[model samples]
Target: MSDPAPDGLMPFQAMEILKRAKAMEATGRTVCHLELGEPGSPPAPKVIEAVTKALPQAQGYTNAKGLAELREGLSAYYSAQHGVSVDPDLILASMGSSAGFILAFHAAFRPGARIAITRPGYPAYVNTLLGLGFGVAEIPLTAANGWRLTGAEIAATHAASPFEGLLFASPANPTGATVDREGLRDIVDTCARLGVRLISDEIYHGLDYRGPSVSALELTRDAVVINSFSKYYCMTGWRIGWMVMPEDLIRRTEILQQNLFISAPTLSQIAATVALGERDYSEEQKAGYAANRGLLHDGLSTLGFALGEPSDGAFYAYAGIAKFSNDSLEFCERMLEEAGVAITPGIDFDRVGGQGYVRLSYAGKRESIELALERMAKALR
Candidate 1:
């Protein structure tokens, strides 16, 4: 039999490793989980309260496009927060950004067409592209650029091997790196010239520390904007999210969304609509992430783990683990086994340069994060 994902990734592979760790925990080993991007905050108080009132009315599925009320809330939220206007008619709801990603990937590009994404980015991006039978094109972004994507890089990159679309995530996974407004505009303009479909994974929107979040809608109208209640709203398990597409792509995306997910859950949509109204709570969570990022920033530097970039957003610090472990996979397993710290090996991210890195997440409670830093300090030493 052939081996699956010669790349060492797969939702199942992640599960297999986590499963063993989970099974081991049955015997009661301490596990400090820093491996996943799963948010750690409680759902907003108002959202939960809405759910309490929605149970009897939300037992059945709603329209395949999701509750119009929820879609309208998303539209208004984007316009008010981002200085951009999106049509509720253009919104297609799905079961979290995972479903949105698949639908967009399928609708935007055909199988065997190439797609470009940054190295050491979200592992799921590469996995999703390949699973759709597409070619993986690499754009090696370095720490020098704030891990930012430049127009020149995209234009020069495609000269060697081009792609049909580009996927980007500011305040990105693992590294927590982001781009400024000018940088984002450069990337979008270049893609427009290259005839590349741009899919901006704005799942981590509103989680930045330094400045405002930049949206693709601000730069170009011809991109797929995928977002979720999963991140900013702290509704990870509810499986609800949405997409913003160009006017022309709306019907096509709706067709795919219909077959792929009969409809978004009725209760979750009701709850998420209320979430859009709770800006104060979302900002509070963003502030907490900023504080955790600072604690981790000072602590990790003290522990001697060389950081990849000056992380300004998201909840992770991707570091160069070269001094301690030549192999990130072996290192992650050892961190779990010896230090009781669970972290993700970098190989799951950038296949080429990932051997020397591991990611640490600060998404846990304050005390748990401190405990992890204490243990990792010793492990690194």
Candidate 2:
């Protein structure tokens, strides 16, 4: 048998921190969770009601691409949210963005293809590429530049050696910095010029605290756009995500999804269709995230943690912890053990410049944020 795929994948540090925090809780310690990026709010009431109503219908497998209604709903959503028209036929739903990424990699790239990904990015991007026997060109980002990845950076990296694909995220994970229309157009143009396939991760689009998040779909029809109900919709456990692929790639992705996923959770697809129509529910959740973001920003700054840029969207504050410790892993471990506050080490996102950084997720309740801050202040002092 093949040796278990190369063991180069790093585990998500936030989940590991959660496990440790749970163990502490088991021992009667109260822990404030600031590690994972899950929303504190529950799924929309309409979503739950829809799921409950559909449960007795013996919901079965949907088309590999997704239910017609959900796909249409997603198309309508994009049209309303970004003012971009999308064809329902181009949408394919998978278990989550994770599975969508896998299907996309298989459909768009061949084994051994070199892909460009930004460091200080979601770890799963690199891990998944390596697992599929692909070469990765990691472009490093810095706090000085607000951690933005530009077309110039991509061009410089490609000049060093050719790469076939590029993966990018907006309102990015960990840092939460978002690019504007002009910047996005530059990257899209560069990718087209270089003949590189682009995969845009827009999972956190609706969770923006600053302004609207731009979708790659607005600028190019040549890219694969992946999104999920897991973040802004507060449905992480539902395991539903969708991808909008170029017209030519639709059939290929559908075949891959047919074999790999068969369908996204049927119940989730049904409920998500309803969830999309409940705009007020989603807006309320976004408001909570905005409040939590402010609390984390002021609280962390007061604790001397340096933030790179104002997190334009998403519910995280990736702060510099150099003033406390250069070893972020050790620092976080100590925080969990002594401060009763759990956070993720930056190494999981940025292997090179991460040792002095930490990612604090502010998706928890206001009381929890206040408590964590108080405990962190006392422990660090």
Candidate 3:
């Protein structure tokens, strides 16, 4: 056997597709990239200026929690943007939401504790929890219900097996389905009643095309909230994010951060502090994403792809491929090799129900979306 694939670890198929697409580009082929969810735009000019200014100073580590100035700014961000008052001390800077997930998983859950996540959810949530030795309970969602996670699902899942935590994302990846405020409140109330710790992944907060995203912090301080500058702020390479820790988990997460990370990158912390003030620039970027979304939606539908609900937020279009092929992976491979287009197989997000689906990211330029759709039409249509 070929090294008996690591137990409980599944490949992130999107990144795997990205790697292959890059190798093809190395051969001087011009591939239209829609596989990864990275912003086509660069960081705001003001953010760059701040980082350049900070570069001359010694970029040493901040304390485990991160720079006080940045945390204070994040506090103000919640107040002004979300209408919530979060204490600066409870906010811990992390190395992207990836690290924030790791920290939150470790600090919040006991060893071998079972955590519930939605099927058709972010792959990392399931993989990370499994890699860390936690039992994963995937609650299945469907297009019939608009791909929503609900209080009934949580309560029913908990009643059957009794998980210790529930981790979910509104404006979720692959689908870009957002839970509205009323729906969110019900889920929050259910989790509280069922004694399940909630972890909210709000990385796509500012990219909501429907309306503003509802922060879990607005409903409960007990939930562990995680966010990053990667998506809406277009700062992926910076590898910086933040977590609002539950009061009980603060000291543990801080101690874990001290040993696990020491601190987030000094330069990124400085950049993020300035990024919070660049909402106008972020909004302009969001408008571009909206146009790209419309382009992708209309193009894919014309090609007979059934996207359940139009993405309300985030920059992804999760489309059903039943009209094209039964195997999403094979379909994606053929698309890449023959059509010179790159997108992710839906099996990366939902192992069971995703074989007939694929996710195309609209986080790239309008030209890329147009090109990919054109190439796909010529090849498939």
Candidate 4:
């Protein structure tokens, strides 16, 4: 008899580590959580107040494209923040960037079409594409180039084995490698030249430390851009985000959202609209993340972890663990069990080259990061 099985969708390892940490905390053990890309801050007071007022009036599902109010706010956001004009009609609110990705993938590509993504990237990009019956080609980014993805690499990879789409992020996950404006332009032009549809993940946009993040909208109108209130606004649990779709993909995406998600949470859409005007709160949070980034980077270096490139954005420090161990999974396990510190294994990001690396998130409080450093020094060093 043939075995009945589902597609092998790998678990997101950061969540696995967080689960272990929570379990330890449940048993009276103190744990320093450095896993997950989640910011440990609460949502802005304005967001909370807005949602509180919205709950009583909470209505039914919005149109599949989301509320006009939310979509209009997002349109104004791109114009104000990125200096690029986006039509309100081109915007769609999503149940976090996860739904946005699913809708974009289905609308942008046919079944079995190949897409290019970076290694040491968000694991969901590869996993989601695979689960949807699409092929993925990974472009490896290394420390020699500050872990940045370049136009040349895209061109070369396509020359060898062509892909129909490119899914990319700046201030990338796990690594925090952000591409500058010139670099981003090169990548956009290259994708245009190659006729590869680009899907830009800009969830971590405003969290950049080095400089401003460049949006694909500033360079081209063809790319599908995704952003979330979860990161910048400290609204992860809200599960709300928005997408800027190319003209060609708008109707297709709208139809997909109708069938697949119905719409982003009605309450979240309302709250997210308020979030767009509360950048002051988000900016204050960014300053705290900047400090945490320094603390984690310096502390990890002191422990002989080789940190390549400045973590110019986001809140993670992806450190090479070759100095301590070769197996990142086992290293993380030992760290959690013995040191009471929970971090994600690099294998979660890069399947082939991740064995010698680990990703530590610095999105928590200053005291927690200090405690983690102290514990690791005593336990490992």
Best by TM-score: 3
TM-score of each: 0.95, 0.97, 0.98, 0.97
lDDT of 2 by residue, 1-381 (tens): 012234677777778889989999999999999999898888888889889989998368988998999999999998898899999999998898999999999999888899899989998898888888888999888777888889999999999989999999998998998888898999999999999999999999888776788999999999999999999888899999999999989999999998888889999899789888987888988888888888889989989999755598888999999789999889999999999999999998987888989999888788999999999999999
Give Cα distance to truth, residue 13, candidate 4, Å: 0.7
Task: Flag regions of model 2 displaced more than 4 Å.
Answer: 1-7
Clashing pairs in 3: none
| C-alpha RMSD of candidate 4 | 2.4
Local accuracy of candidate 1 as per-residue lDDT tens digits, 1-381: 113567533553234457657877899887777776767887889899999987877788788888999889988888887888898999988899989988888888877888999987887788887777888888998866667778999998899998899998998986888888998898899999999999999998888878989898988889999999888888989999999999878888888877888898888899899998897998888777777778877887777777754587888888887678788888888877778877888877777898888777777666767888898877766
lDDT per residue as tens, model 4, 1-381 = 012127756778888888888989999999988897888998888888999998988888999999999999888888888898899999999999999989988999998999999998998998898888999999998978888999999999999999999999998998999989999999999999999999999999998998888899999999999999999899899899999999999999999999999999999998998988999999999999998888888888898999865598988999999988999989999999989999999988998899999999998888989998888888785
Ten contiguous residues with the weakest lDDT in model 2: 1-10
Question: What residue runs in model 1 are displaced by over 4 Å at the alpha carbon?
Answer: 1-3, 6-17
* lDDT accuracy of residue 169 in candidate 4: 94
